[model samples]
Target chain A: MNPTYFLLLIYIIVCTLIITYWAAKHSGTTKQYYIASGTLTGYQNGMAISGDFISAASFLGVVGMIALRGYDGFLYSIGFLVSYNVVLFLVSEPVHRLGKFSLGDVVCSRFPGQKMRLIMAICTFIISLLYMIPQLVASGFLLRLLLDLNYSVSVLLIGTIMTIYVVVGGMIATSWVQIIKTVLLMSGTFLLTLIVLSNFNWDLTLFLNKVEEGTPLGEQFFLPGHLFNIPIEFLSLQLSLVLGTAGLPHILMRLFTVRNTYEVRKSLISATWIIGLFYFMTLILGFGTVALLGYEALIAKDPTGNLAAPLLAKVVGGDFLLAFVSAVAFTTIVAVVSGLAISATIAFSHDIFFHILKKGKTTEREQVRSARITAFIIGLLSTLFALRLESINVTSLVSMTFTVAASSVFPVLVLTIYWKRFTSVGAITAIVSGILASFIFVVLGPYVMNPSDGLFKTEAIFSLYNPGIVTIPIGFLGGILGSLLSKRIKQKETDFNSFYIKAQSGYSSRGES
Target chain B: MEEKLLNYIYRKRKRLFIILIFALLFYFFLPLSLIFIPEIMNKPSFLFNLPWAWVYAILQFPMTWLFCSIYHRKAKKDEQELDAIKGEDVN
Candidate 1:
C-alpha cells in the first residue's frame, strides 16, 4: 500500500475514534444509549436514519447496477425511497412513542411479557446478524480494492474497528458518524455526477443514442427493450425490491429515532426527496460511465462495475478524484456499519439482557456498558461469518436482508398499528413464521451458489432470490394465526388504542397536543 | 343503506382497515391485474429512467394511499364515534 492510502485509512480511524469518545462522554443515560434519549428531531434523525439505511451496499451497489444494466438499477432507489411513505403513514408515531428501545419494546409494550420480548429479541438478533454479514463482506471487498490487500485481512480489520467504535461510543457515535457518512455519500455522488455530466456533451438524448447504437439496449441512458427492459425474471425481481424494502428492521428502527408522528411524516417526505434526487442523479452518472469510460474501459478497469462511478471520477477528474471516491466509499461502509453495530448492541443489551434479565431497572451506566460490549460481540460474530462466506455479493445480499425485514418486522409492526386484534400471541407467531419461511426459502430455494475457494468455505442458500412477496404475507398470516388462537383475543382493541396514542404521542410533551 | 357504509368508512378506522385491505387485494389481483400479473409485472417504466416494473413499484404507494385515503376520511369520522362510546360527545 502506498504511504498516502495508508495515511488516509489511519485518518478515518483516528477521526472516528475522536468522534466516538466525544459521543461517549455525553451519552451517560440508558435512554441515551437506546433512542438517543429521544432528543434528536426528525430532520436530524431523518438524515441519520438515511445515513444508517443507505449503507455501503446502497452507496456502492446501486451505482454499479445502473452502469451495468440501465434503468433497472434505479429500481432499488425507488423501492428504498418509496417505502418510507408506508412507514410515515403507517408506523412513525406508534414506534417512536411506545418503546424505550428495541422493536420488541414496541410490540410488547401493550402486551405483558418476557416470553414475547425474548422471542422477538432472538428474532431481531438472527435477522440483524444476517444483515451484518453483507456489511463485513463489503468492507473486505472495499479494502481489497483500496489497499490491494487480501479480503480476509480487510474484514478482520474493519470488524475490529467498527466493534470498538460501537462499544465505546453507544448511539451517539452511531448517529454522528451516520451524519458524517450521509454527507460523504451525498457529496461523493453529487461530485461524481457533476464530473460525469460535464463529459456527456450536455445531451442525454444524444449520449444515449450513441450507447444504444452499440449495446443490446439500442438506447443506453434509458433501459432498453420496452422503456425498461422486462427481464424474463422481472416479476421476481420486482417483488423483491418493492415488498422487501417495506419490511426491513434496521430501516424501521430509524423511524423510532425521531420525536413525533408529524416529524416522522415530514422526514418521510424529505427522505423521499433526497433519495429520489440521488437516484435521478445516478441515471446521469450511469450513462456518463458508459458514454465516457465506455464498456471496454469498464470491463478492463472495473469488471465488477463496483467501481463504475469511481472510475468515471478518475477518467474526468483524474487520480485525485479516484482517491476521493475511494475515501468516500470507505466512509460509506464505516458510517453504516457503525450504525448497524450500535443498533445490534442496543437490541441485545437493552432488549435482551437488561430489560429481560434484570427487568427495566438496569442503570444507565450499566446499560451503556452492555450496549458497547454487545456491539463488540456482534461485530466479532459478523466478521467471522463474512470471513467464512466469501463469495456472496455484498450488495445483493442486502436486498435479501431487506426482504427478511419487510417480511418479518413489517407485518407485526403494521398489523399491530392498524389491526385491533393483533395479540402478543399473534406478534410472536408472525415473527416466527416469517423468519422460518424466509429461512427455509433461503436455504432450499435454487440459487446459483458460488462457493468460496477453500479459505473456510461458506455456502449461500438462495441468491437472485427475493422472498418478500411470499414471506411478508406469511408474516401477516402468522400474526393473524397467533391472534386467532390467543384466549385473550378481545384485548386487541384496547391494546390497539393505547398503542396508537403511545405511538402518536409517545415522545411528545405531556397532555394531548 | 349503502350511504351508511360510506359514512361509516368516512368516519371509522377499524372498519376502514378492513376496507383498505380489501381494496389492496382487489388492486393487486383483479382490476390492477395488469400491475402485478406475471406479464405486466415484468415490464418497467422509463419516466426518470425507472424500469417498467418500477411503474408498479412507484405506483403502488399512491395506489395504497388512494385506497387508504378513502378509509382515512372514514377513520376520521369513526374517531367521533369513539368519543360517543366514551360519553364525552353526549354532553
Candidate 2:
C-alpha cells in the first residue's frame, strides 16, 4: 500500500464527512432531509445529476472497453449521452412538478391510492437496490487495489460511509458529494486527456494512426461490431441505454432538488452539456489508452479493461496519477451509492412508513428517523450482498439494471404522464409485466443459462443479452391493453383535465400561481 | 377556454412527437448503417483519413445540443404563453 494513495483516500473521506456534519445541521426537517427544500440551483443540481449517473462502470469499464473492443465501446458512451434526450424532452419537468419526495409521490399524484404508492415504492426500492450492489462491488475491488485491504473490509468501509452520508446529511450532503465528485472526475479525466495528447505532440492524425497500430484489430479498430457481432444485440443494448435514464429512481429524484420547471430544464440542459463533454473526453481517453498504453499491455494487466484508465495514468504520470485516477473512481462509486441509498430510503420511509404505515399522519421527526434507519439497513444489506458477489462478473448488472428500468418504470412513467386513458390498473400492469419480462428474459438468456459458465448447467432459451428491445415494447403493450380492457368507471369531470393542465404548464388549481 | 388550451397542448405535443421521431431515427441510423452498410461507414472521411463511423459518432454531440436548444427555446416560449393565458383567466 502506497502512502500517497492512502493519504488521498483519507482526504476524500474527511472532506465528505465534514460536509455531512454541516448538512446534518441543516436537514432537521423532513423536507430539508429529502430534497434540501428544493434550494439547489440548476447548474448545481445538474452537476449532482452527473455525479449520480456516471458510476465506476463508466469511468473504468468504458475506457477499457474502448481500448480493447474498439468502436463498440464508444457506442456505450453514445447511448448514455443520448438517454438524456428521453429524460429532457419527455419526463423531467412534469416529474419535477408532480413528485415531492419519491417516485411514489409522482405516480400517486394521479392515481391517489395506497396501491399505486405501494407499487411505485416497491419498484423504486428494487431498482435502487439492484443499482447499488454493483457500485459496492466495484468499490470493494477498487479499495482492495488501492489499500490492499480485504474485499469484505473494503465493502464494509464504503457501505458505512455511504450510509452515514445519507442518514446524517440527507439530500444536501448527497448533492454536495455528487457535485464534488463531478468536478474531480471531470478535471482528472481532462488533465489525463491533455497529457495523452501532449505526449503525441497534439497531433490528431498521428494519434489515430498510432491507435490503429497499437490495437490488434488494426484498421478495423475504428469500425463497429468488434464487441457485438449481431446487429440485434447492439440495437437491444442501445434501446435500453437510450431509454433507461428517465426511469432511474436516483436520477429522477434529482429533479426535486431544484425549485421549478424552469430550473428543471436548466438542470437537464446543464447536465446534458456536462455529460456530453465527459463522454467526449472518455472517447479520447479510450483511444489514448490504446495509442499510449497499447492493447496487448492493457489486456495482460486486466482482461476486462477496467484498469485501462489507471494503467494509462501510471504509464504517463507514474504512481501519483494512478492513485489520483483510482481515488476519483472511488469517489464516483461512493457518490452514486449514496444517491441510490437515499432514493431507496425515501421509498421506504416516506412512501411506505409515512404514507402506508402511518396513513400519511406521521410526524416529521419520525419520518426523518425512519429514513435514517432505512438508509442504514439498505447500506448494510448491499455490503453483505457485495461480499458474496465478489466472484461474479458484475459488468452485466449495469445493463441489466438499465434494461429493468427501461422496461418497467419507463413505460409506467410515460403513460402516467402522457396517456389520458392510463389508469391505475394499467400502471400496475405495465410495471409488473415489464419487470417480469425482463427478469425472465435475462434469466433464460446467455447470462444465466449457458452450460459452461452460467449459474445453471443448461442451454440458453432467450438469446438476446439485453432483452430491452423485446421487453420495453411488451411493457408499453401491457399498459395499453390493460387500460383498454379494464372495466370503465364513470369518468370524473375535472380529474384528467386538472392533472393534465398542471402536468403541462405547472398550474395547479391550488392557487399558488 | 379549456378546449383551446387542450388544442394548444395537442399542437405542442405534435411538434414534440415529430422531433422525437427524427432524433431517434437519426441516432439509430449510425448503428443501422454500420450493420447494413458497413462499406460506407468504414470508408475514410475527407476530414483526416478517419472512418466515417468515428465522425458520425462525434457528430451526435452537436446534434443533441442543437435539438435540446431548439426544445428549450420553444418550451420557454410556451411557458410564457401559458402564463399569459392564466393572466387572462384570472382577469
Candidate 3:
C-alpha cells in the first residue's frame, strides 16, 4: 500500500537472504552451527547477545512505556540491564561450564535421568514459550500497523522465514543476524530521538513550558502521574522490572556464547553504558509521545496503551519513519523468536534427546538434525500459543515471564554457587516450587485484578511488577529443605570440593585429568 | 578450617563478584539516567540528552567481553576440578 511498507518487506527479504547465504557458507560442522563452535570473540557475541536480548518489547515496547509511564517504564530498562551483573555474578560461569550446550544441558548434567532433562526443557519451553508469545504478537501488530497486513499473514511470514534461518544456519546464523538487527535497531531509535529533540528549543524550561500549557491538567511531560500511578504502583513496578531482568532466558543463555570470565565482567560494564543511555532515550520517547498524541489519543489508539511508541513515531517522524519503526518492531520479533527457538532446540536436542535418550550415541549430524527439527516444532507451538492466548500488554507479559524465570531458575543457581551443603533434592524442589508458584501467580494471582481503574485489572496481592519478594525466598527454602530431607551424598560432596577448586582455577582442562 | 573456607569464598568468588558488578551496574543506572534526564529538564541536558538506545546498542560490545572473560575463567576452574575429582559422568 505504501513505499514504507514495501521497503520493510524488502528489508525482511534482504535479512533472510543474508542469513541463508551465511548459513550455507558456515554450515560446516554441527558444533559450529549449534554453539558457533564457541569461537566468537566476546565483542562479536556481545552485540549478538544484546540484539537477541533487547527484543521488540525492549526496543519498541519499553521506550513506549517510558513515553507513556515515565519513570515506571525506565524501571524495566534498569531491571533488565542490572541483571547482567546477576547473570555474570551467579549464573554465567556455572551455566557455561556445567553443560555442553543449553540450560537443559547444565541442569540435567547434574541430575539422575531423562526425567530431569525433560523437566528442565519443559520449564525452558514454558518460560521460553511465554517469553516468545509477545515477540510474535508484536510482529503481527507492527506489520498490521505498517503494511496494513492481516495478523496471520504477518505471523506466518515471520514463522516461515525464521524457521529457514535456523534450519539452515543454526546458532551462527542466528547470532550474526542478531548483530545486524542490533545495528539497525540502535541507528533507527537514535535518528528518531534526534529528530524529536530538534523540534524542542533544545532547552529544558521551554520544552516543559510548551508541554504544560498544551497538555491536560497535571498531564505535563516528565511530571508525575502521566503513565503510571505513583507509590504502590511505582514500587511494585520497579521490583518487577529489576527481578524480571535477572530471569529472562535469552539474556542468561548469552553467557554461554562467550570465551571467558574476564570477558563476562568487561562486557557487562560496557553493556551498562549502552543500557543506561538507552533507557534515558526511552523517557524522551514517552514525553514525545505525550506531547504529540496526548493521553486521550494514546488511550483511543490502543486501550492497553501498548501502541503509544509506534503512534508517536507517526507524530514526529512522518509516515515513512512510522513504517520504518514498525518494520524494526516486526524484525525485532523475528530475531528474538529465532534465537529462542535455537536455544530451546539446543537444550532439547543435546541435553535430552542425544544425551539421555540416545545414550550419547547420537552423531553430530543427527544432533544438528534434531536441533533443526526441535526449532521447527517450537516455532509452530509458539504460533499456536499466539493463536490461543488472549492478547496481553507486551510490558506485563515480559514481567510475568521474568518473574517466573527469576523465581524458578535464579534460586537454584545462586545457592549452588555459594552453599556447599545444597543437595540435588534442593535443586529439584526449588525448581519445581518456583515454577509452580509463579505459574499460579501469573495465571490466577490478584495482581491482574482491579480493572475498574485502568483498561485492565492488574492489582494482584503482589503488584505484577516484581514477585521476587515472595518467589525467591520460597525457592531458597525449597532447596534447603530438600537438601535436609535427602541423605547427604557424602563422597561426591567431598570430591566436589576439589571439583570446586578446579572450576575456579580457569586452566582445568589442561593438566589434572 | 572454617576460617579458610570463609576466606576462600570471600577472597575469591565474593570479592571478585562484588568488584565486577559495580562495573556492570552501569548498564541500568546510566541508560536510566539518559532517559531520566529528559524528564527532569525541559531541553534534555548536556551529554545527558544523548539518545540512549543507540549508545547501549553500541556499548554491548564491551559487556560481551566482561561476561565471557568472567565465565571462561570460572568455568575453566570448575571444569578442571570436576574432571580431576572424577565422579560418574551422569550424562
Best by DockQ: 2
**Residue by residue across B1-91, what tens digits does model 3's lDDT show?**
2233334444567656765665556544443444455354233334434334334533544564465456556645644544443433223
Which regions of candidate 2 fall more than 4 Å away from where they truly are? A489-494
Error of 3 at A437 (Å): 0.7
Q: Candidate 3's residue-wise lDDT over A1-513, tens digit each? A: 787668776877686677767775776566777777777676776677777777776776776676555544555665566566566666665566664566666654444456666767777777777778877877777777666888888878887777777777787888887777776777777787787677785765555454455445443344334445434444444444555555566666666666665565444544555555665666667666666677678777775556777787888878888887777776677788888888777767777788778988967778777877888887787777765553655545666677777777777666665567766677778889888777666555443555553334655554444455566667668878888888655423333454454344332333442
lDDT of 2 by residue, A1-513 (tens): 789988999999999999999999999899999999999999999999999999988988888888998889989989998888889889988898888998998888888888889999999999998889988988888778656788998899889899899989999999999999999999999999999999989999899999999998998888777898999999899899999998999999999999988899899889989989998888888999999889989888788888899999999999999989988988999999999999999999999999999998978898888888888888888889988998765756777889989999999989988998888888889999999998899888988888898887789898888999999999999999888877485422238887887777777777754
Candidate 3 chain A, run of 10 with poorest lDDT: A504-513
> What are the clashing pairs of model 2?
none
* Candidate 3 ranges beyond 4 A from true positions: A108-113, A217-237, A390-396, A447-466, A488-494, A507-513, B1-10, B17-91
Docking class of 2: medium
Best by lDDT: 2
- Residue A208 accuracy (lDDT) in model 1: 64
DockQ of each: 0.12, 0.73, 0.11
lDDT tens digits, residues A228-267, model 1? 3333234444455545544555666676666655555545
Q: Give the better candidate number (2 or 3) by DockQ.
A: 2
Q: Give the top-scoring candidate (TM-score).
A: 2
lDDT of each: 0.66, 0.89, 0.64
What local lDDT score does residue A267 receive in model 3, on the 0 to 100 scale? Answer: 48
